[model samples]
Target: MAGRGDIGVRIGLSAVIFVLDGPGLSVLTTHAQEVAPGLPFGPFDPTRHRTFELALRAFVTAQTGFRLGFVEQLYTFGDAGRDTPRAAPAGDPARQVSVGYLALTRDALAPPSADARWRPVESFFPWEARRAGRLPLIDEFLAPRLRAWADAEPGERRRRRVEALFALEDDAGWNEAAVLDRYELLYEAGLVAEAARDRPEPPAADDAPLLGQPMESDHRRILATGLGRLRSKLRYRPVLFDLAPETFTLSQLQAAAEAVSGLRLHKQNFRRGVERTGLVAPLGRTTTGTGGRPAELFTARLGAPEDGHAPGLALPALR
Candidate 1:
């Protein structure tokens, strides 16, 4: 058996790509391409690469033409059968490990072609609600399986799993930061495409849609990892500023936060949070109202840590 140290760590990158929201807070995308045809998996070229970060930047730019901004390491995925078989001579029975990263970019960048798409984040993770609505996707698909899993074992063990996974029993509330837990739950229930090959047949419609779009190999899972990181990071850190334009009205900044987080915010409360955080400095300018009164504009306070020290923004709080 291969020891833990013997595992091969292949340096690879995946972008949890996002774009600016339009009027009424609509999500957009610039680079939307299929993984296989655009980026084929092969040997990690050492000579042509200087560092992993540089290689990721180069790969994304070369493949989709979108320049990346505000990128951070998301997670590392390594499972025995995760990677597709390598080409003939390169065939090695070693597991492939991928280092995922999250990236934010402006929609000004055009995606390569039709094979790639920049659909809203809702298209995939429908459970992430931006409006004041319940996630039917979860109620319809995930809840049942989670209940089953919770009920599998009795006593404290079972109770804990249920509470941790579903936030049930005590109205403990859903912890949005548990992104990986949510994905893994869906995977174990065979609701996601990543584990499709392992199962004999397709799951019922209730479970089918929960998986969202299937990416090449485990790319979708990697993408999910990145998405989870981005969502949680927004709360404690000022990373959202990276996605905003230079000067933006308070409402525009809130919209940007909602677009990325997939949840709405209370207008007054959001303004208060921004003010308390002191992350945005007033621009001393105002813009005419979209329908009501004009609003003041501000820019994200720079020179502080990339990770800001604010009351982490939450999707539910905003809603």
Candidate 2:
């Protein structure tokens, strides 16, 4: 619904480049104008680029100085009732649609540029990391606040949504891949800093919980999309190998899986299942780096033995 002078559509590109290393799980982010960080982002130049993927790769490399590999389109985000405070309001009246891509790498590297660096995924979405079992943030802090937020509204659906998203009825029912759902719920309830940034008016209550670290613009939403996509992709695609070392011990592989999935996997079940799938083969050598008895080293065999089609691993959670 443009009156007369709307610039119409503006296309931008962003990357959610993730890596697993000593820091556990982390994503590459460039310094944003505000205190928060943002995904590598730039406008898509249709004149210079033939494809969206190429444009994404070009800017991500320019901003982070690290070329991307094993990337996939995540989702497109539109500007609607979102506050991009330091944004280019100059276009004064143009809608921006950012196409986000998920990039996975085996190692974390120092971005050749000073503006970009790797930040732990937990720093922004700490609640998503549940591999260690119960989180006090969920039980003691997040639940009560979210329950209050739901109750303040005039609908039973809100309460039901809270119960479903948080799995308050059954702790074991929590879905790790629903990162976007949970984050969107939090944003809707004004329990996060981004909520405050977006809303022009003051918060409904002074005590509204400001949970998790914030990101510039809607980059966090894009990140939640990437995280959720990665979690879900693990079930049917061998994308985890893109984020694994060239060679690693079975223990290391399990640890990487646990880090990404945010679930404490059952050791015996995980090992048996992985071995059964023929997704990995032992190197006939052992590594003492695990700080215990020698553990056998293994390499990822991305393709299945039968059809050469790679399938994702099954996570045997320690329920």
Candidate 3:
């Protein structure tokens, strides 16, 4: 008989591959017919793969046909109920744990398989992207519902949390790095589909407010975790190069940053910030077909310096 320590624990691997697709940050996804799309995921077979990262890379490449670069381990999601429709197949161990990884690329390739796709990141959390000035869903649907949820609590805890995470009230400010926090809060308040998926009685359509499109199982939550981590890391690291082409104009670089953060950055201020970091050098090449004026091309420095300075300028305070 197997001992307690010998219980089979299924090891799964998932990848949240971020690409700077046209006008936005996109994620590589796979669909299991009739179910929501999810990150490229597969089981980790120790016999076939030497390491967790290698296993994840293999699975994602097999699913999306796009090789990943600049990969990093994001987090481990082992919650008991996280394995949804894709729960271990018959005769497999009942226990499961998934190791999540983050990968960045400059291009979103056409999927080799019919079920794979490159989806816009904002589709999973529409409220996170601010490119369209202001999203009506947040103002007309999310705010009122969140306020009601906060007020229902007898103590000040939930209310304060709502204010902090969503930047409610006059003085509170939005924190771009709070992506996961905001998503989890919405889930707790029963405003997202995943929360309803787990509940015995799902909320009415009016109550759930179609928070973007849902992913299969808890994959959306894992994507949120990756986004939050990447947002926070951008402040201290020169990791954005992983998502940039070998050569690009300053305007192009700034646009990439804006797309990832979902905020418009002041052109002059952003350029100044980039200059101060000394992270890019002239490539001695220029593009003349911009239709306005010739633009100089630049390449990212070989290494990201850690000088204890806040990266790029923070968004101008929101009014």
Q: TM-score of predicted model 3?
A: 0.91
Estimated TM-score for each candidate: 0.79, 0.93, 0.91
Ranking by TM-score: 2, 3, 1
lDDT of 3 by residue, 118-150 (tens): 889888988887655555777778888888888
| Stretches > 4 Å off in candidate 1 | 1-10, 23-43, 85-94, 112-115, 153-159, 167-170, 200-210, 305-319
Pairs clashing in candidate 2? Answer: none
Candidate achieving higher TM-score, 1 or 3: 3
What is model 2's C-alpha RMSD? 2.2
lDDT of each: 0.61, 0.84, 0.80
The candidate that achieves the highest TM-score relative to the unseen native structure: 2
What is candidate 2's lDDT per residue for 141-198, written digit by digit as tens? 8888889989998979999988887877655487889999999999898888888888
Please give the lDDT score for candidate 2: 0.84
Question: How displaced is residue 304 in candidate 3, in Å?
Answer: 6.8
**Minimal lDDT window, size 10, model 2:** 82-91
Ranking by lDDT: 2, 3, 1
